[model samples]
Target: MKINFKNYIASIFITVLMVSIFSSCTETKEEVTLLFVGSFTDKKTGEGIHVYEFDTETGKSTLKHTIDSITNTSFQRLSPNGEYLYSVVDSQKKYNGKVAAFKVDVPNKKIDLLNIQDCGGLNPAHLAIDSSGNYLVNSNYSDGSLSLFKINNDGSLSENSQVLQFKDSSIIKSRQRASHMHSANFSPDNNYVFAHDLGADKIRGFELVKKQGKVSLENPKEIKTKPGSGPRHFAFHPNGRFGYLVNELSGKIDAYTYSNGNLGFIEDYLTYQQKQHIYRTADIHISPDGKFLYASNRGPEEDTIVIFSVDENSGKLQLVGHQSTYGEHPRNFGIDPSGNFLLVANMYTNTIVVFKRDIVSGKLTKLPFDISVKNPSSIQMKTY
Candidate 1:
């Protein structure tokens, strides 16, 4: 065979060029992180859900798309795999709330609604999907119920299979006179689900039992919070050894040591410095590294996010610092997957503020640019 050395050399060069191009493309895709914000919708200035492209390098976010038809999307979450999105229609009317699922396409900036289902209770405030993405737990605020739904293969939600209603009340007459479940969170192991009840002042736990393809919550346990603490949101440390609950009415955070399916109380810390007539501590989240915990406190007095350094070995917290949200009503906030930024959804101010986070100090500094979205209610971020 006659060898063509020139042709062979050219072919090798082309092969190397193709390999470099493919590697670049893959890195670009992996670097993308999307910010999904759910907002309260009204007839006039309604933006139901907005998605943004978060630039990890610059710490800036640009609005990518908006879905305006879904009304009152107060809370939204992405599936464990980042292939689906779920949001809640936070209704005030009785039995009129819903949970909707969508197929998320980040590169194309599209979110197609898969299906909507009745929440089986009033005012679906929060929803969380299990690690397997096979089960969804929705907490209804007005009626104080937790509804369980199974996720279909295509990411749509099945009708709620079970609804657990709570009729207990707490010491506060006006706020705790009736049951008001605020949020539902899954355990780090996905073997249990916990619901925070604001009105009843209790953290309710249920063993998640999955048989074949169906799922149910069994072995319900009620752990009483402070009499008037009004537990609203719960977050577990990444180590799975500790958990924290933000008390809405009393402006306190309860720390607990978690083991198996039980929570042993550690202590409680005040979320704010001064006492006030009303305290609306809203959201709680731990850093990806589990070194710090951030909790939001809404205004009647001050709008701030309190930062605490975690004692990794002891599962205790030391107050690190506080950052003003730079807007009113810091209802919910999210820390990026890289732990480099924190975004706050100030519902009353109708803006989303991005803050550069100091991983060492667990402090937040306001970024120069912020997003304007009407009634921004919830903040969720996913890396795709």
Candidate 2:
């Protein structure tokens, strides 16, 4: 019959304004960071590396991709430029354990396999890339050796540049029967490499020498830990003067003053106050901002993350608090690039739990959401 022309005009104007506002908001939204989770694959359990899109603002994660061909990608490291990712395949078969390189395609959220090289030892567990991105180092647990690889210009790995095996064993009869190198990392200056040997109870240092574009290890030095300590992982503070060595057997953290790649002992801090239960310490990490340190431990009945506040001036750690992982056997954990969230990969429970971090207090509060993956051993993040 009759139409109200004024009302119709007002409705059209409101729709146009709302669309413009929505478009502007969408255009200004921040991009999501990509998180890559490595896991142990098997015949009975689902396996592969999982890619997740993480929202920094809301601390939410969504699975984006999965790569299943490689088994036992238990540990991974990203190149400094974020253009390539390297992972160690932990296996017991002789010379079967390998290190693999993958070219990262960030825009499409895919990784192209570049090359896989034998790690020159058995059961390669951890790997690290040098600051120049020219060399890769790996620690072999079963054979107690360290292997070095040169990086080609295109990010593929060259043949093993060097491999050094250890013969010494500590006093522990069962766990330290032979030297087992658990973790390897480059010094802040990239002039030295530190390999933490669990069975030897020592953090061994080797000079990284480059001559005429070829790299070699020399001038071996050893930093002894407590008897049967079983140092598993190492982390350097952002200040480059302090180093943290987490002992897997004793459940203790050793603070060291690092100068010119030499580590001088500072003090020992216990991860757990109560000593009644057996402690199985797993991983250690420092926050990006260098304000806090976190260590994961899997006890007989409980899995927890211990937090500590870093004293910037003195390079000392003060116990802050602890948070239960709500899962079993937290093998590894990672801090987001922003240091706002922490993700723990509980191996036995097969879950990755997210926790919101309180930067000011150096505390972790569990988030409601948890990611389910089979035998998740490591969690690493890369920002887009």
Candidate 3:
């Protein structure tokens, strides 16, 4: 046998080359940049919706741009893929009340209007994408109705195949006068849509039915809260076993068990208490890690955030601690994709306050970062 050192060196180089090529091909892609969106429509000035951009790393956000012609851009939603952004406005159109879509330019960090769709009802406040992303769920606040629309690839919204109006009185009439769908959020599976109706005083659940390129709602169910609770914003547990709903009028959080997108009995419903004064709750979110739940309390002039520990097994909540947001009226906030920071949207005070999470206890300490905007209502992030 002739031993050739030169050939051995060449073989080693070829093997190294192949390994490098395979590694490069198999490397996972970096997460997309996170885009923060907030809508603002000034009442007195007849202004339009304001959109902003934020650097997820540094907790820095700037007013990237604005989209005009929106009378009241109250809530905005990002497509499941993060390619398109949708909003609800106060429209006086012929048939459709008010809903519009915008193409999200992920690279330039800009937004452009796509098309407006008739909401079929008035005061459209919440929009969500079906699990298949083939349909858009619209929650009309004033009419207490929910609409489902077929979404096109270009980000345009078509008419919904079905619409449901809820008119139930759940143990409370003063608060549940008629019916008011305050917010709508989807479960992890996207098969179920939960609409939080303040006036109706119930969390309405609708099942998503898919056929080819179209989608509709089915398998309706209702979860009633305490009389006068006024459920507004809702969130689900990470493991899909629990759900949390924030009560607007009573300043309480209702924790429940969810199976197949339907909510069961309330395991533990507690109110946010700061010292002796009871605080009214605004927005609530569960930590991405599924260990903690953070709820925002706006006390007219004073505001604070309460944190709770989630029992991984029973899906119960244990009060952790409360922290001040250093702002007023925190209507909405977004937990960063990394779960390291939370940016609170203070509407009355006009600023997005940032906070760092204590990993062990889930308590939030205000960070020295604040993104300013005019009348920021909803905040969302897109990691592209």
Tens-place lDDT per residue, model 2, 322-362, is 89998999999999999999999988988899999999998
TM-score of 1: 0.93
Instruction: Report residue 102 deviation for candidate 1 (angstroms).
Output: 0.5
User: Tens-digit lDDT track for model 3 on 28-106?
Assistant: 9765455455556653224455555656666666766666556767677788788888877773222345678888886
Model 2 lDDT, residue 37, Cα: 90
Q: How would you encode candidate 1's per-residue C-alpha lDDT over 250-318 as one tens digit per residue?
A: 999999999888999999998886787999999999999999999999988889999999999998899
lDDT of candidates 1 onward, in order: 0.90, 0.88, 0.76
Clashing pairs in 2: none
| Model 2, runs deviating above 4 Å | 1-30, 43-46
lDDT score for candidate 2 against the true structure: 0.88
Number of the top lDDT candidate: 1
Q: Which candidate number has the best TM-score?
A: 1
Q: Positional deviation of 384 in candidate 2, in angstroms?
A: 1.6
